[model samples]
Target: MMSFLPQLSLPLPHHCSSSKPFQNPTVIALRSPTTVSNATTDSGIQFRRKLLYLRGLNVNALEALRKNPEFRSTPLRTLKSVETCLASMGIERAALGRIFDMYPQLLTCDPYLDLYPVFGFLLNDVEIPFPDVRTAIIRCPRLLICGVDDQLMPTLWFLRKLGFVGRQAITCQTTVLLVSSVENTLLRKLEYLRSLGLSCSEVANMVLRSPGLLTFSIENNYRPKVEYFLREMKGDIVEIKRFPQYFSFSLERKIKPRHKLLLDHGFSMSLSDMLKVSDGEFNLRLTKLRLRCLEEFPSAEVLLLNNLFLISVLTPKDWKRESSISCFYLYQLPLLDVFVYWLKILGCVNPLIVLDFYTFPILQFSSIIFIFLKCS
Candidate 1:
């Protein structure tokens, strides 16, 4: 009881000695190791890549990884394996949805929006369903759709919601093609393409669908399409490829009870060749024409027109007397002017001739006419 007054706080140094030196207080620098920073850099790299992914450039990241010395040694094949990963960064939601059943986890990830190459082929029926699809359409201002039937209409409608309607969203600048089958589908696709500022090419494989489209009609329609492809896109297309069921012509004209055309749903010709061939059926009956690559025309080859028109003329000069071709139709010829000059010397005037000249600039139309007029 004597000193009860301040027994209060005799500094208990034993209990509170500088907070026990923080337990590990030797002042451990707290600096991260280079390895830790490197690991962090890796995470930062992925984060940066995520930025690119959001910007719709995942491909560039992998491409850089492939070229960068640090990761260049990684197997290139693995890149393909990671395509799904990269594609998921900004690829079309509809396309992702197509494969969603297989990879359910990807549905929640953000998609990269790409303006696909303009000349690409669309072989499958790509469905852009509601809600999320609408968001996707809002992202891609211009889109290309191919394949037969109404499968692409949903995408069009989805796009329409994004203020891409009536040639505003899609116009001659946008392309929507319907492959060989489905009549109504072609009309729908054409309407959609025209709306998105695109004009569809009546390509070799897809021409038959545009009804009342004669050779000349097809050619006329094709010219602008070709020009658009050449000018705006420098010859490219948006693709929606699918496994096509290609059919081949029957060797026999008579339909075999069980035989059908071979099924191949892919490109069969080079880009230029495809353009040339797409206009083929149009001008089915040409007269007084100059052709380039006459030898390359399948029609000429099939009917032996080259052999009939040129080879026949090459026979003995006396045979030339019997080789008078009035109202001649030439296909795939390159030297039309020269051939015409030769024909003029032989007194072949007023003959109705059909021509399918090949590999020349359409801009030369005026010069060609002047030449023809001078020769006439």
Candidate 2:
């Protein structure tokens, strides 16, 4: 009976424990729950760090884990599946870091339930083409985090009602606007524009023409620009309705500088002419205006120095071909000297040239010089 019983390990007696406390071999052989739990936790953390490192998210992996609690417990395979899903939709491996960094909650999102539905809505409901699906996501990464039923569907409905359908339908280029809140963001901007003496239809037309109008902030962008347009430029609201892109131009950089330049020269330009052109083109147009001013009013020789300097800098081939003047001649000559030289060249061909400053407007003066230059 004793032999049949299993042999048991016994603890050492305190008296026979040599200098040590009595110990049980069985107890020493097993690990505590805390130790096992700690080992598991450490392994899980290391695995997550490796996963993020492999996916280019090492830059902010710890921050992501801390911020998104779901990420800490999410299975390794689930995180990989999210990456695989985005990759299938044309999101580049490099772009994944930036997207995840911006929205770390996406790390734990179920690909089928959370991510694929957004892609489907973009492709099917928004009518975004397959290739442009990547563009929309890259442009507005928040689109993935937004719920299709709560955020995206409601926004799309509001936009369609506001006349974003047909040719002016929301496309990949303007898909970023879809993430904006309908009550807090989109409607507020529309109502603000309407409050500025524009009818609802007029505001809708402006937004259709320039979708970026909806993105402008009321305090930072809309208020200041509208105030400047009315107070300083005395701009007509009708112009803004026709060219809503007027709001897109920087108030400090493009609007003020160009508007001041035109005011200094006693000239007025449409918002399109003032802002729609490049810096070089604007300078060329200003120089042309000064040239017209000089020819119309010979007494205004002061215009020549500034105008000639601009001509020297912005020397178009057409001017060189028309004048037959070398670059050195234009650069070196004083305003009066250049004016005299031009007159001498014109006198040879149109000896009977007449000056009528009062009859013709300053803008038409360029035609007179072109006529003489062509005849020569």
Candidate 3:
């Protein structure tokens, strides 16, 4: 079983022969401790510190600096500290991003403008469940524009997206209240509000609350939609259509004291005719009609003097101070002196005239007599 014999040498493979192959050589030399120290120092201060610290203690030198108070306040140092603390404590990036996202850039740009308090209040009070800041940046409150020429605004569209249909409804309701209160005429504002899914009761409440909001104007005469809102809200709220509205003559843009009064008084034409008529009728349907435009027509003294004669013959209720009339608002005819005199003669002590010229009209000498007469 143990036969020892000499074997012949076979030819080696081509790849295995060292002399025929192209080979690359790499040289590596282990340095002394002084050389290692010098090499580590040349790398960087932080690198050198990390290298030295890694050899002895278990943790990095940056981790040691994190607990140092001297490097605490500066933003860069604080950031480094936070980074190390987060790494050591194993905090995730996603959670920090979620909390930081609530801070608005505008607030951050000017925090000393009391922005922090305002932002904090809004953050606490407005409990909208938005997934992130992007959602809040896009949405806000909206105001529904009504009147004959109303146009939608960008905010209105945004509000609609945010489920604010009430503004649109309010506009319609306002029109309905306007038409219903004023001589029972129908308006389109009511219909539009109804279309926006608000009830008649809602519109009535709005009218009672914001009466001065009646002065609304929109673009060149669109077919306004307010008829339904008025029809439905009728009788539910107090009638405010012809309720004694007043405007101080002092505040009027054009009309002035010492100016010849253009008493564009009672309308002889029917309501239909007046509605159908053009602006040219402003001259014909007015009270006094012929008062000058001040620049052209010299003195109104003649007309005022002649009117005094007429004033003598008429009863107090019919006292026609025609040419000298100061408050000549045609639309609000029920508030003129003629109606006030009539109301007074009919034992109306408490006159509800719009033009109450108390101090100027009633002098100190005549005041006592007037008071005596009123008391009697």
Write down the TM-score of every candidate: 0.21, 0.72, 0.17
Instruction: Give a tens-digit lDDT track for model 3, residues 196-303.
Output: 455666544443444333333212111121222135212121222222121111212322211223312211332223333333343233323322221122222122
**For each predicted model, how many residue pairs clash, with residues at least 3 apart or on different chains?**
50, 0, 20
What C-alpha root-mean-square deviation, in Å, does candidate 2 show against the real structure? Answer: 11.5
Candidate 1 regions off by >4 Å? Answer: 1-29, 32-58, 62-284, 288-376
Better of 1 and 2 by TM-score: 2
TM match of model 1 to true structure = 0.21
Stretches off by above 4 angstroms in model 2 are 1-48, 51-59, 299-376
How does model 3 score by TM-score?
A: 0.17
Using TM-score, give the best candidate's number. 2
Ranking by TM-score: 2, 1, 3
Lowest-sum lDDT 10-residue window in model 1: 240-249
In candidate 3, position 136 carries an lDDT of 31
Task: Show model 3 residue runs off by greater than 4 Å.
Answer: 1-167, 170-239, 242-251, 254-376
